[model samples]
Target: MGAACIRERLDRALCSHPWIDRFPDTLVKHFTDQGSDHRGLLLSDKAYTRNSRPLFRFDARWADNPEVRAMVNYVWKEEIQGTPMFRLWERLKRLRHLLYDWSRAGTTNSLRNIKTLQAEIERIKLVHPVDWDEVRNLEFELNRQWEAEEIYKQLKSRVRWLKKGDQNSSYFHTVTRARRKRNFVAGLRSDNGDWVTEELGKADIATNFYQCLFTSETHVPNMAERVDNLPISQSITP
Candidate 1:
């Protein structure tokens, strides 16, 4: 039987049947159809066997823990060192590697290690208690560093894609446009009353910018219209 059907049957049998005490963790055995033209039976300890297959495991409870959030925050704080802004950029690289390993192993060893360190700090607090505030501050700083690192990595990935001429897709174009708009706005602001010479020249730049914007708007719609108007047979094959 198919895997889902097998699981459903097994679930019913397990709940109702008294003979079947426990299900084996491993597969029973592979069976072939014989000349009798009948499906092979799956032999288990309990009842008559039928064709069976392995079921995929799903564990949802592990993802919903508050401790997971606390652990992540703690690990992030432990990684931060100097100026939060600059340190975030550097720490992001390290965080990315740790995250990859966490995914592959399906565990958070790095976060767990940080928790152990935090526990040690707590123990020291019991003895002296003077540096407790300092310890807490350091932890907060580390978490901020990790947060900044994550933001930097996400922005870096988007920037890399933009640099690679990957704006053909609608989603890519949308992201590129937003990034460009944000950077342009940020560059235009000045601390003093006087504007930068480059900023003053934006009037000249606006003409070319608007021209390109209009061209893109016109072309994208025309391309979409053309695609929509094409014969279905020409776009698809039997």
Candidate 2:
């Protein structure tokens, strides 16, 4: 930061074999210093763009809603033209779309509602003649929404050992945030030694890598030859 500070260089990129295999095209670019004494280094790759669908996760909070159950029942009853397994898959696929739409239209945003209710309650209390009835009603609604928010956090945190009665919403929130941060893949090295930071590039890299990894490169062995080579008597036993 200053001349008095001993001059030293420690900036470097460290990656393992698995990481290199995943993104062989990883490239590092250096940039001129803007304000800091140290210059900036960016890992990047050839830009790529593609449309991707968001992943669907069934919210546990939906379990408490009767409408969700009814929707699922209605979807499950539909006779789809397919094998048993295919029919089940089709039913689930249809149900997911319906549930997604229902969830989008439903009052799922408890946190915002909780804050609004709290503000309204505070405002009512400031009146010269306190409206106890209104305050009580708002307080009840606030608690209900707060509980729903807590349940949402609890499900996200995935703390199986923690009981629902133990209302540690803040703890659950912290755990959920930490898990998401740890699990998130910010960037990936491509085969060309460039970092794939864009969502589309990263997705392509991962998909290609796994596809190659799982694909059978060797030709299928002859079953008859393998059976004849078995460590057993060829003639019938006496």
Candidate 3:
């Protein structure tokens, strides 16, 4: 149970049902101000299913590393036995696999990696004069991870206003969740008075409505002559 007290006495509390655990539910729900001492619980059971969407993308930042470019050059120099297009596609596919593995190499538990790097830096500073080369490497790794995270957030949120390295991870997370909630269609009432609670049903109902509206048989009445008769701001000679 959690609560925010509006009264001076702190007498109010918010709680979940005793049987809430029996069902898969949490008490971390919002409430409305009903002008009462106690906050009324908002029991929300809205389930928003997000489909797995892994996009095939090449990180342009990988081009910044000379080692990566060298690898690409080597791959291109290799003569693969295939049609020109097929050979190119195969080589690119192989490069994509290599880059994906490289990208994932240090990205797992990035926070832990950041902390570890920070600790190492601190330890080095205390033990000896800071190794600037090691520090730079650590900073580079952190920046790369941050860029990777930003790319993920940008794709997931669909909001392009925010730029990378603005310390807006929290903002991106909030925006992404809000977008998911906004996109969720809990239910829709169909023309036949049937409630479409299923995902496919809701989609069909919305699709048909828009399709019908666009393909409407209603003719638009001509109002060009009526507009011409209306009083004009400029003096008309005719």
Model 2 accuracy (lDDT, Cα) = 0.74
Write down the RMSD of all candidates, one decimal each: 25.5, 13.6, 14.2
For each candidate, give its TM-score against the true structure: 0.24, 0.51, 0.41
The candidate that wins on lDDT is: 2
**Superposed Cα deviation of residue 195, candidate 2 (Å):** 13
Most TM-score-accurate candidate:
2
Candidate 1: worst-modelled 10 consecutive residues by lDDT:
11-20
Model 3 weakest lDDT span, ten residues long: 19-28
| Model 2: worst 10 consecutive residues (lDDT sum) | 45-54
Give a tens-digit lDDT track for model 2, residues 65-180.
89989999999888788556557656886999998887787577887888789999999999989999989999988888877876777688987776644665776766665565
Model 2 stretches with alpha carbons more than 4 Å out: 1-53, 120-138, 161-171, 185-238
Report the C-alpha lDDT of model 3 over 29-56, residue by residue, as the tens digit: 3355578655554455444353433334
lDDT (Cα, tens digit) per residue for candidate 1, span 38-78: 44545444333323222122223224446545545655787
Summed over model 1, clashes come to 5
